[model samples]
Target: MTAADQPPQGGRGPRRAVAAAERTRQPTEVRRRLIVDAAVPLIAERGYASVGVRDVAAAAGVSVGTVTYHFGSVQEVLSEAMVLHIERYYTALSEAAEHATTAAEALRLLVDALFTEDTDRHWRMWFEYWHAGEQGTDEAFARGQADRYAAWHRQIRALAERGVGDGEFSCDDLDGFTTRFAALADGLALQRLRQAPPLTTQEARHHLNRFIERELTPRSPL
Candidate 1:
């Protein structure tokens, strides 16, 4: 057949052997993982722009060229890190989504998980992304903000619909109410993280519960 399509003519297949050797030599998955792992703590601490390829390479114990080889640019690395963070929070949200039986309980559980003692690190990570989003340098950062808000809204609307079906709440505007409800939870979460002697998990849940009950409790059994 054609020279390009046929096997090597060296009779030793040295070319194919070398190509296979090079393929084995390349650390594809390991390099990608190393870049992502090294990026998270650095980006979490210094941010996306402040850290560069050399910095990431140094942190990863690989050469700067290795960093560039794995991720074409620092922005790409940061995007992957942001994706990892999103998946993490989403997993938590998914777990909370499952445990919540009622709409009110779901909101309460979600708030408690967000503000609880063990979640401070996640909160800090989220805060970092939030600041990045404000800068608007990266589209993924901006999309991340929207994705989280949308996911929260979806869960809240599900809860609202469930409440309505159960006769536990009255709402003609599910989207509007869900947005405000999520906003309140987010506001309280920021306060809980920012304020000294942060709201206890129970306290945070109590606050949200009261608000939900007040808004949802039917007046005429509707």
Candidate 2:
């Protein structure tokens, strides 16, 4: 049945009416941004693969028509949501780096921020994007993955450069370390986020810290 045709179950009113009632009056731009923002939690909870236009619309407290009116397709909404979600991830790391006086301090803060209390959901959306790219299922997902990976690589490389400049960290192959470290973090996050007790966040961080100590620590002057 159509949204309007559904009867109120359990006396809470119909889903459509509830959605309409929950969303207060807002400007068009704000509503559009809210729609994108609303998709983030849904993606985290349900996985991006299971989130559809109807899901986004319901999560945003808007109608399916409204969602389509703002976006060309659900794919567009998903792609934008991916970008929005990653902004916080990058921003936290950047802030950690910016606020620190030393590269070592910055690295410690970055790792702490990386393995946050809520990292499971955050990493779920990311791995979903990565799987989409690997499967060649979505062109937009593939393109966005490439762009985001480039940014991630640059962020890691920039930190390495800062370490080298400060004489705190040493790396013979800056580019290689940047790529490998990113991959390593990704792998660790995936492990921690997975079910069946793959690994704990503490173990993951310990492993990553050991890697940093071995690879990035400056050598003694000979």
Candidate 3:
């Protein structure tokens, strides 16, 4: 019989009570979120290679068996945590970029949002992801990274297309513009994170804004 099906042994009152309490504990979804929440920060701080199922179980105040049962393996748990992190990051970016009066404004808001302290942990996790990919230690993580980058490019391209259609900006080559814009933003973020030449958040944002202004010509009013 499974552990859940096993009855209290030795006919002890305390043992039976404990078993009943375990049965009535939070539902699976709640417990799974607890484990993922616990893993996110640990993975961000320690990197995936340094953390394990036991660490996540301890952080979530659950048993190792519970973590294993919910996620099946340490890699699964880490993957879910990274997915959660990326989802939240993308949501924030989308919200910030939406409803902007112009594409230039949207791009500026995105750049500013990326450099904030609120996103520092997410950026750290992203770097950890990149390191894993570079080492060829985690194929799943590398694939996830590629997918996220593609999603980012799609979002940026949509913004560029919107700008052109609205006559707020002019770009002869949307594909080339999107590629260069994304590469510049990523390079700036990595430089800021590494403190190479020590760029302030404002400076980085300003640099991006200038690049946008230079690359996209404002449409002449009819």
- Top lDDT: which candidate number? 3
RMSD of each: 8.9, 5.1, 5.7
Each prediction's whole-model lDDT (CA): 0.71, 0.80, 0.81
Expressed as tens digits, the lDDT of each residue in 11-67 for candidate 2 is 566655666655546677887899999998887888767899999998887789889
Candidate 3 matches the true fold with a TM-score of 0.82
* Winning model by TM-score: 2
lDDT of residue 198 for candidate 2: 75
- The regions of model 1 sitting more than 4 angstroms off are 1-30, 45-55, 196-202, 218-222
TM-score of each: 0.70, 0.83, 0.82
Distance from true position, residue 198, model 3, in Å?
1.1
Better TM-score candidate (1, 2): 2
Cα lDDT for residue 111, model 3? 80
Question: Which scores better on lDDT, 1 or 3?
Answer: 3
C-alpha positional error of residue 192 in candidate 2 after TM-score superposition, expressed in Å? 0.9
- Order the numbered candidates by lDDT, best leading: 3, 2, 1
lDDT of 3 by residue, 93-167 (tens): 988799788777787778888777666677778777666567655676778779988898998898888888989
The local lDDT score (0 to 100) that residue 90 gets in candidate 2 is 87
lDDT of 2: 0.80
